[model samples]
Target: MKIHKEGFGTIITSTIIAAAIIVPTVLLVMPLYPVLGWITVIAILGLLVFILSFFRIPGRQHADGEDLIVSPCDGTVVVMEEVEADEYFKDRRLQLSIFMSPLNVHVNRNPVSGEVTYSQYHKGKYLVAWHPKSSTENERHSVVYKSGDKEVLVKQIAGALAKRIVNYLKPGDKVKQSEEMGFIKFGSRVDLLLPIGTKIEVQMNQKVKGGVTVLAKW
Candidate 1:
């Protein structure tokens, strides 16, 4: 369990903030108001831990098979159904949506190994991750991967609490399955559009781990 590269700045900032409060509470406030200062210390510690955990990158072995689709991020499956894709596909596709809470790992992994064919970032609103409109209306980045004759799309969406999104892949780049694609700071959502007729391996509301969970097989 290592601190994810994406959280270096965040962890440092969080540490400074936590220490500012914790040090003062321990050295001065605690001497005067023991109960109140101790509570403040504990609260600061909890917040620091949460921030560290959010950026943690746990080791994981990606799902096997080039045809298997792995989860892009750790979160709960919020939407799974056939939907009309208004983006690249412009046709009906099976969509799987994952909602990432602050408690979940924020690293977005590649669902499949392929050459990136389409990559775009959109400026938009910051609604809650589960909001239906957030998938399209929220600040997001979309990347499509192609392997052989199959192509899949993944979108990283910003939620009400998430304001920053980091995507490293661009068109023409070849990415490996389960490799880092992006990181969404704080809470967010990820949408995966699979080819029609693909088998859905997970159900709605199911919790999934990034890189480790098999979403479906192409």
Candidate 2:
């Protein structure tokens, strides 16, 4: 319901655009150059793009169950593969990968309520979100929450354009479903590896709201 301050990068971009236009108008208007006026228009357009990227849409759903499964990130479902998870799960799982573009909201949330059982940061390569090798190659933060008799592992992977990944939770930190856990810079992807036989309520290509839509149910 509230639009928080945008990331520092986004704020800097907006500031550059605003100053490029308004500052010149106040200091260089004496010359009355027509070229500068046109430039001002372009700069203002850039500011709008920065605003859109920082805007946050209100969530439309809430959690009401002991094991509710909220969407881990705001993005379109691009992949649902049967792959063996790297850690924690170790077994084959239904890996639901959501590709978050630079335009998508980068805030990630807890999908279920539980204790933080495992958390690890892997410094690796920055690959494309959809790249099959990205799951192993990308710089990723892996966090596992043991909730309702199941262990849910959420991996925040930084893509080629993303340079920073922020995870706010730590060991023993009790996270609630839909609570803000971290934010990914620019663009990246979040992969949720669910246990086999878990009921998935989302379709492949469906747009999901982080902390809102239930991707699955135990």
Candidate 3:
């Protein structure tokens, strides 16, 4: 699979950590394998953690169309309901939330082929990603996309464990349904607020693939 460009730093840092643990264990502790076998096991597990955390999977492909809607991130659907977007842009919308566990790929993808009309990052507190209050209260980057007449909002939110929220795309940038937009560090979430009458394809607690699953359609 292709490693995402946004995950380069994560991969590099993980590699360095693995090297530090393995080389030192083999060179300095290999001679003590009989007595320090547990130490060797610890080193092996450390390498495994880094490998899993930094790994990225290529997004699944789908046919393109004007009415097509794509999943915004690779994670499990945590919230799916009609709710009011009360904070930045106050309006009633279909809120479909995806919870990004640390094990899942943290890269956020554009939900549709659109021209970004508005994009801005808000500095705020790190709240639990799944918390209902987190949607409007947590640190996040908001992106409004215009695909023809459709306007949808995607928010990259920081969880309690995630301190850094990386958004690479800016306002006015054209984005494709399958293109990468940003990566959230550690555990986080992505919320897509859609207009009324948008078909809800997925339900709460369901798993969804970025760019592969259709969450809504105009």
Identify the candidate with maximal TM-score.
1
TM agreement with the true structure for every prediction: 0.97, 0.87, 0.88
lDDT-better candidate, 1 vs 2: 1
Off by over 4 Å in 1: none
Instruction: Name the Cα RMSD for model 2.
Output: 2.5
Could you give the C-alpha RMSD of every candidate to the true structure, in order shown? Answer: 1.0, 2.5, 2.3
User: How well is each residue in 17-84 modelled by candidate 1, as lDDT tens digits?
Assistant: 88888987899999999999989999889988888898898887777678799999999999988999
TM-score of candidate 1 on Cα atoms, chains taken together: 0.97
Counted clashes in each candidate structure: 0, 0, 0
Which candidate, 1 or 2, has the higher TM-score?
1
lDDT string for model 2 (72-133, tens) is 88899988878877787768988898999878877888999989988899999988887988
Query: lDDT-based ranking, best first?
Result: 1, 2, 3
- Cα lDDT, model 3, residue 114: 84
In order, candidate lDDTs are: 0.92, 0.82, 0.81
Ranking by TM-score: 1, 3, 2
Ranked by lDDT, the better of candidates 2 and 3 is 2
Query: Least lDDT summed over 10 consecutive residues: which range in candidate 2?
Result: 1-10
